[model samples]
Target: MPRADRFLSIRRDPLSDEVLARGGDPEAHSLLQRTGFVPVARAHETYHRVPTNLAERDEARLATEAVGRLRSAGYHVDCEGDFDTDHRPVHYLPLGASVAHIAERIREATTTDEVADALTDLTAAHDGVLAAVDEVLVALADFHEGLGDTADPHIARRLRYLAEERLGVITSDLSHTRNALADRHAPHPGRSTCTEQVPSNERERSAVCACPPPPRTLPAPPPPPVAAAMRR
Candidate 1:
């Protein structure tokens, strides 16, 4: 079956006259934002909207660009006629995917040192992911400092607070955890570590190693059947 994230739609809400986008995954959301849409999160779902007061023509262009970009990346977009396009812009790997790769590495790691090594990409003090985020927060704060909006200064302060308080706590905790894991020299209990050294006492001389065969993966059982009364 096709994944839910592979489809999205863009259209102007008839009553509100607001250009809105719905039914896409995080990657599609990123494409919408890059093409000048603001995300609005609700309890049930999240969607994107064109900024208020944007000229009608500009809104169409923005939505059309997002449609083209999403289609280019192989997502199916159901959009208004005005936003339909044959254009498919080239897509590149997003930077966030690199950070997500670290999580994948940790998931596949069998030893404490391997997990710690993967975390170093996030916890490194000089050029790590958290450090880059801190730099971004500070840069955003600086941008807000000169903006003439009544709330810009307050926004700047809030950004600084987040960088210093929230992100700082996360960075400190991860750094401590990384250092601890680096020192542990322990293998994960649930995972096997293959040293690739055949046992000296092995009766079979052609044995490659002493490691046990990988466990078999079993399929999940089907859900219980609904009673006729419940169906009625």
Candidate 2:
């Protein structure tokens, strides 16, 4: 397994007697060896827009609960869906972003200072959530951007970097992202072949990038009105 630098390693099985002594499983022990687990709560696989049937009620409740927990923990979760793909009818992004919730806060805020306070709260929630759990950074990035339009320079730069530069959210379908990257950047001045694909948990994995970090995320704003509302 790669070194556990930033993220903690989840072990299915205990490796040492001391671990087993502490009630860690010894048999069937295996580490989640993906040294690079992406912040994947918002992955297309785990989400559903709104569970509709009674059988799904618990899952729906859990989903909302998860969102609440993530918000409390400091992740900036956002909802996204595509017309295609039943798997991702809706999912949360728990990362840095620049739209929707933040924008709405800006609009609803009574004063310019209020906007600043609101953004601070939103970002605090984001960073706090990511302190232990990094999986929700994707959608959370944009929650305060007002349902999708934000003025955060961080979000703006990331969006510009991806939409225009063609980075992140790369395709997993037959490795199209790799191919496209290779075609565009492989021959660039002093750049290597585009062989390194951005993993799904794209941001944290970039800490070791040979180049500067790609704009998968920017810092988030805050959430003061939210705190005030809660205090009431």
Candidate 3:
């Protein structure tokens, strides 16, 4: 899908007023630039720790579709979200993936202890992220601070990607669901909503749906970018 159609954001982060006053696009190292790292971190934690727990309907679908290994290696089947009837969501951790990454990082690090430390830290950080988002967003703040400019670029990028995708799915779902709710039910009278209003008689309101919104059909998940990148 074209980047334009896939995401609604004008840009992930736009230049701030202060930066704009200074000059054109801010420099790469500029602290003034806005980034979704905070929420993204939480999202990453959520996915790595509990893949099935992704809140947005579209995200879960996309993640399942993106699992290239699951497809190529055989035993690949995606049951389109019939969880309400068929099965419950469950998270499957890609331990092999993590171990492979850790090994590669260990090769790059200076010492065996450093390698061990890095591996431990990465796993802990990953778990910390998951726990924070699902169980406690506030607690994740501390986990965020512990990270610095030194982690592998790929890991950071992946986490950020997961976070943004999740945000999109969630934001879209909520907007859609809210519109449906408002069209059918009044909120505090005169409350504004983009959802369309439906007609119903006052006496028949209990029997009839006033302000009935159209059925919500979530957009299909965009195809995974690449096989390697899409792997859990």
TM-scores of all predicted structures: 0.83, 0.16, 0.19
Error of 1 at 95 (Å): 0.7
> What tens-digit string does per-residue lDDT give for candidate 1 at 1-232?
6698899999999999999999988888998888899999999999999998889999999999999999998899999999999999899887988999999999999999999999999999999999999999999999999999999999999999999999999999999999999999998988776789888899998988888777999999999998777564
Q: Residue-wise lDDT of candidate 3 within 1-232, one digit each (tens)?
A: 3222121111111442111111112221121121111111243231111132345554433333333222332222332333112222343544445556755765565433444454443334346323334333333433554566555454555555555566446545544544454354333333333343345435654433455456899999999877566567
Give one clash count per candidate, in the order shown. Answer: 0, 49, 3
RMSD of candidates 1 onward, in order: 5.3, 26.3, 26.1
Decide which is better by lDDT, 1 or 3.
1
TM-score of 2: 0.16
Largest TM-score belongs to which candidate? 1
lDDT of each: 0.94, 0.34, 0.36
**Who wins the lDDT comparison?**
1
Predict model 3's lDDT versus the native.
0.36
Ranking by TM-score: 1, 3, 2
